[model samples]
Target: MLTTRVVVRGLAGLLAAMAVLVPSAPPASADQVRGSQSRVLRTLGVDAAWRVTRGAGVVVAVLDSGVDPRHHDLAGSVVTGPDLTRGANPRGVRPGRLHGTYMASLIAGHGHGPGRADGVIGVAPAARILSVRVILEDDEPGFRHFNSEARFENVVARGIRYAVDKGADVINMSISKDRPTRQERAAIRYAISKGVVLVAAAGNDGAGKADGPYSYPASLPGVISVAAADRALHKASFSNRNSLVLVAAPGVDVFGAGPGDQYWVGRGTSQATALVSGVAALIKAKYPRMTPALVAQALTSSARRRTARGYDPGMGFGVVNAARALAEAARLAGYRHTASGAGVQDPDLPIAAGGADGRPQLAPVQVVARDTGLVTMYGAVALGAAGCSAGCLVVLIVLVRRARRRREHVMIENPQADRRRRAPT
Candidate 1:
């Protein structure tokens, strides 16, 4: 017999730390007086990216704990959407509840101060945040107990649909779950079909472990799974790693607005996910016609890979590079490519295919016939077999078999022949 357990994706370490710091700090300064701008802003090259676009017209839907619209940093940037969390009003943030508010500020916070010491500035400072409350933090009747997986799924699914219907270009789901229901999966597909760029947190449960269970929405096809990295550009100890982790961002000591116009520094994959969503908003704002697939491609293709060779379970393509992704998005805007629905895995071959650590995976390949006249023996074999005499076809078959046997003999004698063949001339 098998049993299934539902786990909420929210990480508690950073939030708990923030709670402790909030009360002891000075009234004027909520927490320690650190730099107003997060180090991640510079790490991700947000300054250069901002010069390109401040995510002017893009609306990023934040599906998490309710966002406080009155927060100074996010005052004009937040557009309050439906509150799926029971007893949580859409107008205000519950006392001490700051998850959604923090996420919003990370995506579009317009700091109150003049320099890095005074206020918080988001990667896309001009982007608008659509606050769609999906996670319930209160001790309501139906959500009193710790485990409310079924209810969580229902509300999150509704939130996704709501964001899409409301014209959200990017849906930022910082919440995570161990498993996904059929309804939730369909909702994700629906969002992708509408060309909404979905981004989610790669769970933070791999502190001392090398591998951990995958988190959903993040693991789902088409959703960009973001892992957390510290200011030093190292993968955060708590950030879960897997093939689904598409990219990483600064999640350690990340500073953002809290409730009651306060600010706090926290570290979690949730913060990393929010940062990626902001970058996606920037890309979408610049290229309004870009599809979700191409947006993902822009991010992964332009990411700073961990190793020079290829992808790794710890960092996926690597940390998110905002400037490079923005540049790539601009370049992609000029190209004509089929718009694939969300969750479409990249079709490119493995960068280090056939290497010691890299195994070649079978992927679909597309072939196109161009106007330039190019012919091969295979084409001749097909045409001759279809319209010419059987004698010609027989001859072609014999020649093909001879070529195959010769190739097989060479491979049997020298298995590393491709390595040599691929060497630079």
Candidate 2:
């Protein structure tokens, strides 16, 4: 019950944040089946990144409305998990899965058809997806209820932990919120500690200018916040300009797969986030043990920096270049590579970044230090509770032995002790 209240209370102003990442309304138009990849591929240089790895052996968790594994491009790649919004709404409310499906296709969609040539090909075409539904579409039934429901208030926080536990190499959180929750921040820290790369949309509230409201998860430390970019390499008019923005990706007129054999062209920071997540997958697929900080380093270091010296609020370091990022990752991993981006094939690399069981591990010293006070506090509480339990057990055992001895003495030496027991009374 306390946990429930925390989750509920933690969502005090979070409802406003959800509207910034995913568009408040469904794609206004351009919803159709495109027979080829969107121009985003060319703009992102994903083909060159493919020479390094097609994101094989990496699992990206998509936390959003829900993904349709049955989509033509996403077939055989998506593994559905629990719906965070289940039963949270009142009776007779159903949600639509347009957003989540679109994001997943951008992350791991493998186009269907002869030679796998047709349909929308994702940035990381060979990666797998763990689809964990954490939100409901705005137009869907119960959308308001889901947002207002206490049980679902901590959906995004829970989804982050769930993805990390499921061995996700990278997490794509195309969703954003204005209100920051303690649970959500802790969850982001947990993922970072576990060496999981997290990417999020920088919000789409930038109306062709700067100084947009900060977006959580994206604004949260250790997360690679992605902003939307246009074909001309300019920040999208709708992309949020904030300190959290790490890198930009193609977000204008982005083509992606829908819930079925359908496709849609949408423009938002959400699409850009998915593309960045795909790039992270490629890095992890090549260097399975690279820490989240280094993975982020690889991205920021190799980006087409917007300025000469430092980062800009609009696009941060600049647009993300996949092939260059791969090269940077290879350099950080101390592995040999060819110009084609394929080189050292370390079969012995550990699958999980830290431990085999996917436990949270300590990050490198040079990595930016994050607040682990929550983890320490929880640990201290658990330790204190365990100590109390042990002390109680010791006292109980001593009392029990004393009682047994008294009973034995009453039977053997003081047979009249029982009769005299009530004397005082």
Candidate 3:
């Protein structure tokens, strides 16, 4: 009886843990396995709705292999893009469609179109897709070999600048290698300077073999590094564990659109990265004024705290919590509104003096038009000054006239006395 009681308690604890670990399933579809839906829409209810309307009007630039322009799910979605593979013709044609197609499906593909039973919905369906291909493609000559003459830096640099010029709010890069050239770092920095929120994969090699010293852009300071997780929310077997990792998202058995008008499922750090990027697009669309820094703060701040606090080798902050992130975003936005309004009190009064961190903030330039009432003191003062000058001059003239009349009256009344005094004198 004692042994049986202990076993029953242990099983109950396991069930409770599973309940907490398991995320809500996505919408029902034919291709769904037991955990398929659980992997797609990790945040259900409010967060899911938040995603639908939030990603609208935001453009997300995807840096990967070439995306299939003709795919039904991706039709009418891709903006102008270029392929960076070394081989093929002068026009960089679509390389092997696997990487780019998969990344696009995870972001904005419309679920591979009809007939295909797998219902794979991207995290942000409304986001505009900007595809920039960077991977090498194979040809009859056994893959287009990148010669020493091929300028990889030039291609990638041009791609990043193009995305920035095109006004991509969020940039997603799924490729990572053991060694990241200096040019790559410069490209990442340029993107950041343009206010592009960049998200990169932490790499698929678990234990840090394939990704040397963390991944390329992920290891960079400003980049948001994302890792993969299973349905149980445990670190994915293939994901590299590193302290530089920023967050985790569903990556294992994640279903998405494939090349040749097909539905497919795969796992990688790339998939996790696409999900994170989609969430960023949603936030940017919802809070248009939010800076990349503030969006990143919202995501990191609202992360679901695991037993391991702060960032860790496996999970940087923890699994990405779309519901919590959106909630925190709402709160941040409210606070910003309150603070912005409070910042611009009566301009008649001097702004309160304080330190940098504790300083009383001034309102943004927009408040001048919204909250201020114009007082035209210049025109009023000019008119008042003119009237006062005229009145003073008139009073002087009237006083002078009255004095002259009084003098004349005195002369007339005392005429006889004055004549006698004058004759005696």
> Number of the top candidate by lDDT?
2
lDDT per residue as tens, model 2, 183-237: 6877887787677999988887788564987887788888999988877888878
Provide backbone clash counts, one per model.
2, 2, 1
lDDT of 1 by residue, 163-260 (tens): 99999999998877767765577688788877899999888777888896698778998899998887777788888879888889888878777767
Q: How well does model 1 score by local distance difference test?
A: 0.75
For 1-425, candidate 3 gives per-residue lDDT tens digits of: 00000001001100000111112233335445313644467542224646436478989998766677666667778885766544434544434565577678778755543553344556677788998865543331313334223455355556777788888999897766555554566566666655688898887657435442566667786789888877687787778888888888877767666556555566677788888888888887887667666678778887764535577667677777766777778778754321235433432222444345564454545535532233566667888999999999999999999999997998899998777877953
RMSD of each: 15.9, 22.3, 18.6
lDDT of 2: 0.77
Better of 1 and 2 by lDDT: 2
Clashing pairs in 1: 221-343, 222-343
- TM value for model 3: 0.65
